[model samples]
Target: MPDLVIALDVGGSSVKSGVVQADHTVYQRRTTPIDSSGPAESILATLAAIIDGHARTLGKDAVLRGVGLGFPGPFDYAQGVCYIHGVAKYEALYGLHMDAELRARLAWGPKPPIRFRNDAEAAIIGEFCYGAGRSFVRGIGVTLGTGFGSTFVVEGKPQRAGPGVPPNGWLYAESWQGQQADDVFSARGLQARLAAAFGRPLDIPTAAQRARVGDQQLQEVFRRFGADLGAFLYPYARAFDAHVVLILGGIAHAMDLFETAVAQALRLPVRGGALGPDAALLGAAELFFA
Candidate 1:
């Protein structure tokens, strides 16, 4: 019988999961909506259902290896406890022992081990092992979405501290143009720029659509964003002696608009994620495999 593991990438809006074989083949990928603002019990039930569903699909003959999750922070990944407060998501789970709570709700005869890692860190590791960062010995993985997420990797291992790495290996809290890096380099930041340009509120998706049709003003917004992001990453890249920069997340889909600016500013190889949304899922599986 083949051993199977469940890998999950838990976000504020949804949970992405997959079943993995021992050889790292991922299948049965699913995205389920979740209300992170709901009660802790509800959240746990949702997660349990996902796990149970996957377990059943594998049938009685399959060996349940373990479960792994890539979750957001500020969390105790080592302890499987939630400390994410004042973040407007998962507040109900604060201080709760997630691993225990989840185990209690599961129906497995012998509950498999559950492990966790920071989502951003997991995504980077996924890319390092199988995607863009595989070609580089040292690299930075940046996810540009609702917020800015980052991780530094050296020789396929995540580095939280060292020369050129910021506190916690996070770039979101860093100052950029008198504001936090997240305030200037995220989806909201792009929307804000678009709004300022047109003197009206604009969403990122709409702006991206316009830019694709040769809207010069909208195109300029993305270009500026790229330049700013490049400037923001420059010092750290130099300090860490990184060989490449891998961009992931929803915003990365607009790379064509800003790729040149980022390359020109950073003077390093900049590439978009090759694995798309699967990077984090595979990264989560690494907890069991690695």
Candidate 2:
């Protein structure tokens, strides 16, 4: 093990990079919104710059032990390739060799070993190692951000299930069962919910504030969000039998707004994710060392 590690969590909205110590402490963290033309080439340039920037900060003798990158799209981690889901704009990376690319990009200055996983997987790692995941083995991690990204954790182990869709067989579920994961259980979905209900623009903070003050429309909107969350989570409980779904990210933290309906849906088989704020940052370093 080296003295220093750099973990890069690449998200749809932002890219966060930070340095971690052997004792699992995080310092000198930096984040920038993901700004690119949504093409593989452009995104690659952006990512490469972030990586280099972090490496430059760790100093010459710190001994870079490893680098871990979490991408937003479905990925084949075994292949070290990321499949851009039209949103990332990198059709060429579908099976592109990442080890080689990373080596080529940061071949200079005592390169530490590198590892890659889905951004969801990385967040789960964050939860399991040091955040909400510290409690149970059978917890599912869900980041309710721009998109809903989830990982199934069994006894502190996150599924390496890449970007490939699972055999959960959701077609009939969607038609008859009601809510789906990405549509109803995401931040973007929350925004859409407020928009659809009010027939006007509804920012995240504004809606939360009005609802706090007993705004009927906003309260209804939040209640509806809770209901949809319960509906979406029902299937996860049935399919994976997850003990707790460790909630992280911007939307998940605002659990107060949707606690009524969301918690109401928690029955015998399912429960809420207890990982509080800073799960992602904690996981960023913990995943690397673990």
Candidate 3:
């Protein structure tokens, strides 16, 4: 029987879970809401259910080895404590011993090691080992979603954030055009830019649709965003000696509008993620194996 792990990729909007084998093959997968607005315990319960539901599918022969999870941070990844506060997302989870509580709720027959990593970190590892980054020995990954998430990896190990890379491998805090990168690189940021340009608000999906139809304003927004992304990553990539970049997250679906600009500005190969959206889930499982 193959060794298996229950893995989760927790995002601001949803939780993606799966039973995965050591070779990065998923046996079963599921997704549920994160319910960030709910009580902290409720959010933990949702994660527990997702893990339990998937583990049950393994049956008696399954050699369950561990549980792995990847989620947003500004939190203590080592301590499993949530520190993301006053941001209207996961704020209810502050000061909670998130890892211990999650372990207590999960009903595995024999408890396994539970490990956590910043969601973007896990996603990049997944890409490095199994996706568009597999061909590269050194690379960077950027996930365009609620925030501008990024990671730098070399020889299959994640590089820590330093002089050029901001904290936790994130590039959102860097200064650009006299403004913080977060002010121009996220979902809300894009919408705000669109509102300022078009005199109306447009949601991310709608804005992406508009960009696809030759809406010059929207197209320019993404183009600029892509260019900003390239500018933000240039120094970090050079510092890390990254050879390729893998773009992930829901925003990657609209790469057609911005990829060229990103590639042109970065002067490196930029490609959409190849693992679909499950890269984080697989990477979470890899944490145990690592």
- How many clashes (backbone N, Cα, C below 3 Å) per candidate? 0, 4, 0
Top TM-score model: 1
- As for candidate 1, its clashing pairs are none
Q: Flag the better candidate by lDDT, 1 or 3.
A: 1
lDDT of 3 by residue, 72-176 (tens): 787788888888888877888888877788878988666567788889888888888888898899888887777777787877777776555556667778788
Candidate 3 has an lDDT of 0.81
What is the clash count of model 3? Answer: 0
Clashing pairs in 2: 74-163, 75-163, 126-283, 137-155
Over the stretch 1-290, how does candidate 2's per-residue lDDT look in tens digits? 44777778766567777877777677777887765446555666677777788887766668677777776565666567766655534555666676667766773566667777766667677767766557676756666777676666776666544232243212212322355657666677788888987788788888888888888988888887777666666666556666665566677555687766765675523334444323555555554566
Global lDDT for candidate 2? 0.65
User: TM-score order of candidates, best first?
Assistant: 1, 3, 2
CA lDDT, every prediction? 0.89, 0.65, 0.81
Highest lDDT scorer? 1
